[model samples]
Target: MKQEKGAEGFSENYWLENYADVDDMDGMYNARDHAHYLKAVFALDQIAIRSIADFGFGPGHLFSAALDTFKPYRSLGLEPSASAFIKAQTVLKRYQPQLLQTDLASWCRDSSQHKRFDLGICTSVLQYLNDQELAAVIPTLALRVKYLYLTVPTAAEQQRFVEEYQFVDQYAYSRTRQQYRELLSPHFTVVSSRLLESKQFYNDQTSDFTEDLFRF
Candidate 1:
């Protein structure tokens, strides 16, 4: 039944049993190593992020790191699993980030932040959303963000993950990188390495960000 809602199979035990050492084991923290690299990207651009939103911040590692690293003045974190949300709260005690134990749709309905975030993190999140939710979220995020960091494994990548990376997630939708890009292109410019620039921030003439060419 929960999967029917959006393949939300997470719980406190799911987080506790699956995650370790902030990017080890069953791949929580949205792969923290990847999150760590973003600091360099943000610094290269000299972006002073004033606001941030983290969707599905499992175990709170990435969001906590973002709070300390970027020091955004306004922040919100959302997790659909109530049990995981409660457990993750322990890690976030030092920061007063607004948190909601709700899925993206619910949060979207209730959010009053008219001002767009300077950065948004939705890593490992979109693949769990069904088609309807995906359709809604892509454009909505474009309107609400300047830049976004997101990740959703393609089927081929998941094959490698299961075999070698110790990864396990039954909820992710099977889609290639190309398929995902088709949905995002109207709303965002898919930048390098799981990063995206919302149409609000994309410029046709500027290649001022990272020079690394994006690949599948």
Candidate 2:
């Protein structure tokens, strides 16, 4: 499906309004989501990981968690939302991760040392991109990092979520598991996948989301 610009299209104003109170936005992803991401990070033990690149590093929680657990030598985060970026900087100040106010594709294109990470993380961000955007970014991510950990709500899962919860967020594009895998196949290999159950904010809505590990 073609990407549609939703009512609030991830613009500066949208983030400013929604994330004005960072405390209120902290519960956007429940504890279950945090556990799932931590589990994914634990799976990286088989491979030696010294550096990490995080895309859409919301609130810097996942990156911070990884740092605390894995203690990678270097970590970098790219966030497009200015409000979230500012919060992440403060939240992750102690960790001292290199943070950038840009998207993944642009960062990869402009940086000479972009392809220097052992792992790449893009959690809860793919659904916001349309097919074309995904096509453009996935390849760059594959080329830049040796491995990628991506988490997104698949089409079927999202359909059930919307129907059961009456929660509608138009900013995201729902795609099937196959569609997501296809987009990444050209540049990476799917190493593993798992379903992560989590709750939405307002209604306590639940869904078994998909998280995939890819080797580039």
Candidate 3:
């Protein structure tokens, strides 16, 4: 939550102020990303999950697919962003209306209150965290969730962040696949992982967004 400049340094507040407003919340960009994540979730044994927790559920748009596809006993979207929280509530009224507005640290600390969710997800959100945050958050989630789904930028993708877009404080580290495995090995088994390469069109050129999904 601290504000600073450089990679791994963007405050949650900065993101909130800058990205709160958007014309289309769910469009081509989001849809493509969502498709990959949804595929990862579908690979799991759906019968094992009674409820789902979208750990970094921004605007809760992605949870819409889970609600429709899994039909869990219940679904909860957690977001620390007040604006995102509010928007998620409004955006997903017909989907999973109940959302828990608390940061990951707080949510994990009070796991007894959220002991029932069988699945936990944090997609496209880890790139903002620094090494410390990721270390603290991952194990906590592994303990609480029987299954976990997450996405993060690859090392190559991290390098492409424009100077102004650099924010590393949010992510304690941007790790390689092997490093990621070493970090998660003590807690849960890695079920599957695959790199997702996507293309985005700029004014007259194409930019690539390389992300990968990890399931534990």
Best by lDDT: 1
Candidate 2's clash total is 0
Could you give the candidate ranking by TM-score, starting with the highest? 1, 2, 3
In order of listing, the candidates' clash counts read: 0, 0, 18
The runs of at least 3 residues in candidate 3 whose Cα sits more than 4 Å from the true structure, single-residue gaps closed, are 1-48, 163-173, 194-216
- Against the correct fold, how does model 3 do in TM-score? 0.65
Q: In candidate 3, residue 66 scores what lDDT? A: 61
lDDT of 2 at 46: 38
lDDT string for model 1 (1-216, tens) is 123344354755555544544445323534456556777777776756788888888778778887777778898888888776887799877888889878886666656857678888987778788778888878888888888888777778888878996666655677787888789888887666677888766665553464545412
The better candidate by TM-score, 1 or 3, is 1
- Clashing residue pairs, backbone N/CA/C < 3 A, model 1: none
Q: TM-score for every candidate vs. truth?
A: 0.82, 0.72, 0.65
User: For residues 72-165, could you state the per-residue lDDT of candidate 3 as single tens digits?
Assistant: 7777777776666776687668764468777676676774764556666677666555577668877777666666666766565556553545
The global C-alpha lDDT for each of the candidates, from Candidate 1 onward, is 0.73, 0.63, 0.57
Give one digit per residue, the lDDT tens place, for model 2 in 54-120.
8888778777776665677898888887667887787779878888888765676675754567667
